[model samples]
Target: MLASMPGLRPDQEGPSLAEQMTALPVATLVVRPDNSIADANVRAETLLNMARSAIIGSDVARTIRIAEAGARFDIWHSNKAVAAYDIKVHAGRTAEMELDLMIAPIVDHDGWRVVSLHAQSQARKIGHRGSSGGARSAMGAAAILAHEIKNPLSGIRGAAQLLESSHNGQDSALTQLICNEVDRIAALIDRMQDFTTDRTLECQPGNIYPLIDRAAGIAAAGFARNVRITKRYDPSLPSANINDDALVQVMINLLKNAAEALEHVPKPRIRVETAFRHGVSVMVGDGKGSAVLPIEILVIDNGPGVPEHILDHLFNPFITAKRDGQGLGLALVDKLVRDMNGFVQYSRDREAGESCFRILLPMGMA
Candidate 1:
């Protein structure tokens, strides 16, 4: 009966699904109906610090017990379709590391399952301060330009309105064009004013999950409706000292970009995760002492990865991949993060074909 099913072969054809799953960047496991391990991926083998031959045929719960002693056992035993929990792994040569585990069932494979695991390392730290002076100067220049243009724009609109009043028929079209161009320039100035304003963040120590949830909700209701959003949160994550409003803006910008990138892909997905990291430090500038950044927020998207051409200048002002984009979203995000003494960087996983953005911030003022 199983052999008769489409895409299901009783005998081996090419590489088994287990073998293909094992080749993925994510750690995977194939379990029998009785929850015995049938196969393990190469990433899983390395993550567990064990050989695949030693792990196969082992009872799934027994393996979990040995590998993740601190894991929540009840969650694993509940037979849930999806679960995420943290565990500590002792790296032989490197320091002990914390890891997040995701377990999900695989359909059409006879009750088998695949588990994806990601290590929680401190993000690559960045200096506390960035090129804020340059940003401020740019904003100043924009503000001046807006002011200079607005005066002439108002005169142009008034002159056009007067000309329309005096026009008999066909010349009204030219007056309308002049009015429309003036309105467009005014709209551009309004957007630029957001940056020109001198606004300071009201920083406080607060839970970041709510901000992430709010942004995710906004995305789902609009641009990201077709995309699946998964959350893997560390319950023990410490509150971060940041401006709640600014953080929300940052998350919204990131979610919007992720949604835009996944528009053409099937099964679009984004993952929001937060955790505490240790041993990561950043230097403010050349010859500056390093300071540790322990709090981390990660936004990961599974879409067509970023283009190679613009990868290097992704954070620069006015850099954008989308047509009709003002290119200020990320620039604003970078400025806001810097104001909160945080840093953001992007990484592309070519093999997995995913783009990941990591934001590192101080836990609290020291």
Candidate 2:
């Protein structure tokens, strides 16, 4: 228990290293001399919304955002362990969390790090890190903006229909385009509303293979027509803890992104694979205990990988690589998965190799 407040004590006995880290409520991370993540405990994974394997080599700065100026400045500079109170820290892509942060240099390993994060108060449990204090203001603006835009859009569509009925010139074509674009904008707002609304998840333990099959089938028939989609599944894998609709939508979003990226590749192939991983668990949702997330779903594509610059913020809202993208696909996927207490991350098996999106979800039972 955290009453003992586990640290990076090498000689600490009894519980295994992984078990000790998993048992502690504190978020602990070890950064190597080169500033990459060498290791991270379960609480850190829970804070960062990634599996320990996926997080192992990611750049430390990109993963954890230090919001304030002085909170971490003196600590990192002095090469000494420093504890600071009530400082804001943002985990990857989610909102910023204010944590009691501790950073210490590992003396034996040439400037390695042992960073720990703890919540100072019961009122400040870490979940829901939205905009940098501007979320409520943004929500109000979105509501008003959605209302104002929809009313005018309805009028424009009605006017365009009238013009299309009466006019037969090329201007009538312009009117049709206007109507179609207006409808498109309306549909986009509906999706945006999905992001803004705080809806409860409809979660359950259900078979995931069928969901993956349906999503992949849709992609192959429609957007992914040029590529071949393959599956490598463990038929005995347990049911996943999730909402079927949300999980299907996540699968479809991932498949569509992969298919779109592979549009021009000659032998563009997409792989959908599932397996059961043992001893993989993460702490999610206020850290009552660790949840065993053994079900693994991987979406591997044989296209040019995701760009390096955007990889760090891949799950953040409005971050996209496409010219005409609003960048909500991966963001929504992240939110939906978190609602189900699942984890998804961008990873590559080897350095500078094929990119893969790995999703680790909890099985029906612990």
Q: What tens digits encode model 1's per-residue C-alpha lDDT throughout 1-366?
A: 122335756664556565567579866777776778888889878876778897788776656542443432333443445423234444322346654455666667656776566664322121112346535765886799788998889999998898888775559989999899899989877766667866777788888889989999999998888899999999998888889888999999989988888888888999998888764444343323334567888889998866777665566556688887776777677778877777787887879888888888778653
The CA root-mean-square deviation of candidate 2, after full C-alpha superposition on the true structure, stands at 13.5
**TM per model?**
0.58, 0.63
Q: List the residue pairs that clash in candidate 2.
A: 95-129, 95-130
Q: After superposing candidate 2 on the true structure, give the runs of residues whose Cα lies further than 4 Å from its correct spot.
A: 1-144, 166-170, 350-352
RMSD of each: 12.9, 13.5
Candidate of highest TM-score? 2
Per-candidate Cα lDDT values, in order, are 0.71, 0.72
Q: How close is candidate 2 to the true structure, as a TM-score?
A: 0.63
List, residue by residue over 326-347, the lDDT tens digit for candidate 2: 7778777877776777767676
